[model samples]
Target: MWASSARIYAVALKEIKQLSRDRVTFAMIVMIPLVQLILFGYAINTDARHIPAGVVDYTQNQTSRALILAIEATQAVNFQHHYYSPQEATDAIIRGDIKAVLILPHDLERRIALRSNRLTQDSARLLNEPIGQWLVDGSDTLIAATVRSLRTMPLNDVTQSALPQTPVTFEVVQWFNPEQRSVVNIVPGLLAIILTMTMILFTSAAIVREREQGNMEFLINTPIRPFELMLGKITPYVFAGLIQVSIILLVGHLLFSVPIRGGLLSLFGAALLFIFASLTLGLVISTIAKTQLQAMQLTVFILLPSILLSGFMFPYQAMPEPAQWIAEGLPATHFIRMVRAIVLREADFLVLQQDALWLVAFTLLGILLASVRFKKKLS
Candidate 1:
């Protein structure tokens, strides 16, 4: 019996040693889940605030400005632009300059003073009224709710004994995501972050490790285009990422009970764009880095800002002006909005057209740049 036990112990020890020899296996056993848990916990916050907003005021009267001031008063939305036409405002949203557009119709001032004259009653009807057709990026319910809440403050009680004549009475109408549940806005963006950071990191180290082992030279000599090679490498990882998303969304749906308000096909399509964009960004990093360590360091640097500027942590509005500009530049910033619009608001393409376009542009630009830079590096 003693001899048998000793032999069994030796076999177990050898198996353990073999498992420990593979760094990936060891890390998977002891580190991956812990790190991911920390990430998921830290990243899954719901308090959305300070959304960037563009204003198009055909009613340039004091009442219009007052209404802008009213929306601004909540400190939830920053009025970043005052365009002459709604088209310009839409352009800003497409440029990723703002998360939503506030459009004041031609007689906005007159309509505010007396409820009878609304210029775009049809537009208002399309948005379900009172919100007056606010054109949001349609991504985040948190900001939508925040804006909605800010829009409908009680009218100044002129008869109140406290104060007889207040200088400004601002009336606001928030167009989308009226209830503003955190789950609605946060989940979609959360989906994007999970796909972006995890898929990129997983593939980043895979290629970098091959290079460290002297195998990537063979791959470099192949006739495959840089973009094609990168795409092939990321394809498997994207599939893995989709599985991860399925797990997360399942958890979100079953445990957290988050609803899927948007069309499933549209939501999945957006997710694919975000995944492609994130993977291309990782490929760009892999081209710049020589080792897995360097790739990891670079990924962390990118990940931090992606979380912060994407309006997942600080409200884009609450950040200082320069910070706001930087936040708008991040891809995650747009993804977060896309997720919110689809999951929380049940928004159609018209409401989200600008955001969808910008995301496509960003994805195409990233792939093109990565391919160019990667080819140059290899040559």
Candidate 2:
């Protein structure tokens, strides 16, 4: 028993020494928890405030101006754009430029006057008619609920008019996923999360695996270039990603009734771009990581931000601007936006060309980085 205890101590000491030398693994150990703590404690917020919104004000009168200011004072929303028409506001929502739109009817003043005029026996229905309504993007349930809370709220302090006890200042009209089904949003976002996990994981360990399995020396002697080798690693996974997408989307549609409303070609095209981008990104990781364990650590480092900041588990708009900027760098963020737009809103492909171009540029840059890094490492 004494000898056994001594051997155990020997092995433990060696492992501690080895761990100290493995800087990447040690850094991951420290950084993972630190990053997670920072993200969860500070970056994530459920009670989203200052959400981006727009206004279509036909009144341009005191009531309208006061109403806008009153809503702004709530800090629930911040109106950044003043659209001329409701159609323009709808288009802006579709483009994801704003989350909700406050539409003030041209006769808002007259309606408020009717509400105040108890002297004449005006119809109760006219008095109760909502002063305005919200056109909300319900793809994000939290943001929808946030905006919905504004419905039936009394703004008498700002309106300076005698309002009903239950004044519906703004009725909310949820655009996509009107039923506010959580699954509708979750199903589409799953595609981004799943692909991001699989595509990157598969290739992040590509070159690392080769080195560990004793194939690196054999390949180094060959004529195959680093770019060609990286492409070879990515091509198979491209097909794998496609298959995964089909399964997720089909299963989502059949099981949850999550509609696939966009054109198949455009959807497929976006998926292809994201898959390539993710896979090449993995290749870059393969060159950076010295082992499979380290490769996986790096992938996890990526996924936390992807899950939190990509508007998957939480509302993207809810996060602080710094978090959003970090999220914008993740490939999953762009894919999630495209998938939701295509599947839920049925947004035209042209409307989403900007995100598509971003993915294209990301894919190209990833490929180049992976190739250059692999070449340098090989030399």
Candidate 3:
């Protein structure tokens, strides 16, 4: 018993010393928990307020203005853009520019007055009518639920009483997800996450694998350009990423009943750009990390933030400005927005041009950086 205990203690001590020596792994051990705590505690907020929304006030009258002000006072919706038409507002929603839009009809005043009277006594016409309409992007289940719950918005100027049940302030029309199934949102988000995990993990270990197999020195002896080498390493993974995408989408559509409303060309185009970006990012990590273990640690670090800040788990509109800015930098954020736009809204690629361009730029920049960094390693 004493001998066995001594051997166990010695092995434990050796592992502790080794862990301490591996500064990257040791640092990751400390950083991962700290990052999770900070993100969950300070960043993630479920009771989301100051939601970005648009308005299409067709009436543009005193009553409409009052109603808008009242909604703003609730702090649930912040009217940022004023659309001339509901179509414009809907396009904005599909493009993910805003979560919801208030469309006040030309007869909004009459509707509000009728609703005010109906609060005292029930009438069939007033019961069926809505003062205004809320065109909501139901891609995010949480935000949609919050917007749906706003049945009792207090109209102070026209009517002092809150509208409850039958004649609500605004009748919500959920786009992209009329059913509001969580699966519609999850499948596309899972696409982004799965691609991110696989592409980055596979390429992150590329150079380390070369070193581990004693081929790195031989490659260095040759006159292979760094950029060429990077292309060679990531090109295969790009095809692999596409295959993974196809599998996930097929399974999601068939098993989960997630709809593929957009053109396959646009979908695959976005995937291609994102795949290159992720793989190049992995290559950059491969150049930085000294070992396969460190490469994996770096991938984990990127993966965590990508999942949390990528609008996959939380509503992007709900996040603070700083968090939003950080999220903008993550490739996953742009990809998730693009994928959701295409799949859920059947949006044209032109609608999501900015995010598409960002992904392209990300791939180009990541490749350049990886090539340069790898060249330095070669030298």
Candidate 4:
């Protein structure tokens, strides 16, 4: 029994020595938990604050100024840009400059004053009147819901002072997702995440597995060029990616009732480019990793940022500018925006042209980098 215990200790010590030699594995063991804690603790905020908002104060009177100040004081909204017209506000929202727009009417102050006097006389007559309009970009369900809550707090305070009993009413227009369904927002982004996670992990393992098993040495002796070999390995995965996209879209629609409001052809075309980009990114990771474990560790490193910064769980507008810039470089970020625009907004090819171009650029750049890293002879 003592000898058996000694043997077990020897094997355990051998494993510790092996683990110490594997720097990538050791780093993963130490860093993953720390990274997760920092990311989840600091980056994620359920109570989203300082939402970028464009204000169109047509009145520009004391009343409108007071209302804006009240909204800013709530710390829920930061009115960054003041627009002259509602059209300008709409343009800003469409350009992704702001999440919501507050359009106070020309007669906003007069209406509020009139409603104040009329509240003493008769409350029923002024019940249907609207004080202003709050146009919200509802692509992100969390932001939209938070914006609604934010708008309520200040409006309630203003109305209570003006008409103690009558509540102030705004024409709350939730664009894209009027019902503000969480599934509608989540399911589309899930497609981007599923594709990213699967493609990166699968492809990252490909070359590394071949190298580990000595098959890469055999392939290195072949007549095939490195770029050609890389392409061959990536081609099969492209179809697999499309299969994934199809299955996810079908399941999402059937189970969640998520709508595909846009053109199917356009959606599929953009998805193809994104899949190619993701697969090539995996290949690039494979080139850097000498072992399957290293491939997986690197894949996780990439995926953490993809999930956190790609606007999957949180709104990109709420992130700091540096994080936003990092997100812009990720294929998942562009793909998520494309998926949301296509599925939720019914956007056309023209609407998604910029995102498509970015995917194309990423695909090309990834392929170029992977080919440069890939060697004709085993390294």
Highest lDDT, which number? 2
Runs off by more than 4 Å, candidate 2: 161-168, 376-379
**What are the per-model C-alpha RMSD values against the true structure?**
9.9, 1.9, 2.8, 3.1
Kindly indicate the candidate among 3 and 4 with the higher TM-score. 3
TM agreement with the true structure for every prediction = 0.61, 0.95, 0.92, 0.87
Better of 1 and 2 by TM-score: 2
How does model 2 score by TM-score? 0.95
- Record all residue pairs in model 2 with backbone atoms less than 3 Å apart, i.e. clashing: none
* lDDT (tens digit, per residue) of candidate 1 on 1-379: 9999999999999999977765544554566456446444544345545677888777676666766776676666778777888778766664456777777677653433343222365533333234244776544555555555554433342122243322322334333344444664566667766776786687778767777787767876777777787778888877777677678777888876677777877777777777777887888777777668767766766676677667775565555566657766777877777666666556555567677788788878877877787642333
TM-score ranking, high to low = 2, 3, 4, 1
Candidate 2, lDDT over the whole model:
0.87
**What overall lDDT, based on C-alpha atoms, would model 3 receive against the true structure?**
0.85
Candidate 4 runs further than 4 Å off: 81-95, 118-124, 153-167, 320-325
Give a tens-digit lDDT track for model 2, residues 1-379: 9999999999999999999998889999999999999899988999878999999999898778987888888899999999999999988888778999999998887777666554566636676678788999998899999998888656475556564544546678998889989999999999999999998999998778888887888887889998899898899999999999999999999999998888888788889999999998899889888899999999998888889889999988788999989998998999888888888888777888888899999999998988888852343
Better candidate by lDDT, 2 or 3: 2
- For 13-77, candidate 3 gives per-residue lDDT tens digits of 99999999888898999999999898888777777788889999889877878778877887888
State, as a TM-score between 0 and 1, how close model 1 is to the true structure: 0.61
lDDT ranking from best candidate downward: 2, 3, 4, 1
Q: Per-residue error at 204 for model 1, in Å?
A: 1.9
TM-score of 4: 0.87
